[model samples]
Target: MPRQRTGGFHPRPTVLVAVGTDKHRFDRLIGWLDDWYAGSAARPTMVIQYGHSRPPTIPGAVPFLGHGDLQRAMATATLVVCHGGPATILEARRHGHLPIVVPRDPAHAEHVDNHQQLFARRLGAARMVALCESQAALTAALDAGLAQPRSFTVTADADVQAARLAAVARVGHIVEDLVAAAKPRRASARH
Candidate 1:
């Protein structure tokens, strides 16, 4: 016999924090979120995966989450706060959550380059994600997003869809090139 769903439905707002799997720490974003959570009047259920970043000294914060666990958390989350990586942002969108993005800064040593900042700005301009470059911006976004969560539904316009496809193709090509370069070369038989 199959198990049946038994629990009565009770809606509770949830927030998911994903800081990516980079080697460098994103303490700036973690600390800011901690402060925001502490100051908020109506606190939602918060699930955080700090990755290589230091875990916040807050009640619900955790150092890391496995892939399946992160997916499960995101599925239930009303809001997603994440580092501005293309894959992470897309994953949040795929889960029907428009993420509030804080890009890693090279100057802050959060990344080796400022590509995330540039990507976040472009995505923000396209209305795909909320860009939070500073604590004030993050706080404002959090207040608004938590009050009313937005759907990340892509429009059916052909031009927009084409543009998105092209951008994704470019990123795919870049990833392919990087992977190819990282592969070990075979030794010459004539040597």
Candidate 2:
């Protein structure tokens, strides 16, 4: 069982590695992270949920983690390192983590296809995640990200907030129109 941290106690500059639950293994990411940690002098306290990937020899790695455990780890982590699955990315973002993402390659049998790569690329383009395509890149990203961690805060800009509200209103109107159209018309009674 993974050890649970409670109260206000948390290690500074913690790194959380979540390889996701894809049946296809993501040992590439895990192995590279392990190597990076091994080589680095300032290794922050690290915890990993390896999932289907091979468990690292590192002390803090676990084969899998429950949802609550994963969430708690994310909440306390200074840097989130993860595979490029959409749900994982979203969860990391929800926890205000700008995660270092390494999308699984289908050629390497790390995923069913290249969808994650494409999705990761889009998110990377939007500056939502730090995308790493290779072991070298992952090492560099880990170093840079750990050196200066950035949290993903909801935009404080009034213009961005207003734009989000407008988009939500538009979606609400669309849903209302769809519901109204789906209702059956009542026949008028003849005298």
Candidate 3:
């Protein structure tokens, strides 16, 4: 079984790569990230922040926190590349971390709705979030954003309330699932 790596990266330019997508979207994103990062002379270190216990180690890539540490670790990252979830976005902003938002597609079923798409659209418009739509876009946006970030207090964001509401909904889902699990299954009597 795959496990979260608590040990941090050794000393290279660190970039946090957070994902909430499955294999397909993940493979695509990883390939894209690798291709983009290949040519850079800087050779920045990457820490994969994800779940399902799959070893995220990609040779040059560094292993750090898994899904659980995502929010906390991302808060301390120099550059955060994350799935476009409101909570992740809010968390990155909370730590004053510069972010590159990668929207996981609907086809991947990464999320119920393509909130990433909507969030990307809004943040990209304001230039607060680096909306990486393509492999090339990732590099271009990363370069520009890293050069000079426009920092602001994360609490100032309007989406904070929405993230809090979403957290409540998630808790509700967990509780419902637990209740369902605890309930005894009804059985039919055989003739």
Per-residue C-alpha lDDT of model 2 across residues 56-139, encoded as one tens digit per residue = 877799988899999889878877888876667766765666778898898988865576787678778978788999899889
Candidate 2 Cα outliers beyond 4 Å, as residue runs: 1-11, 151-191
TM-score of each prediction: 0.78, 0.74, 0.61
Residues 1-191, candidate 3, lDDT per residue (tens digit)? 11122223335446677775333345556766766666666566567755432444354343345555665556545577877665566556555554688877666555444546776677778765678878788887666544433331133344674465456436534643553454444222331
Ranking by lDDT: 1, 2, 3
lDDT of each: 0.75, 0.72, 0.57
User: Could you give candidate 1's per-residue lDDT for residues 135-171 as a string of tens digits?
Assistant: 9999998888766564422333455644674575378
Off by over 4 Å in 1: 1-10, 151-191
Structure candidate 2, residue pairs in collision: none
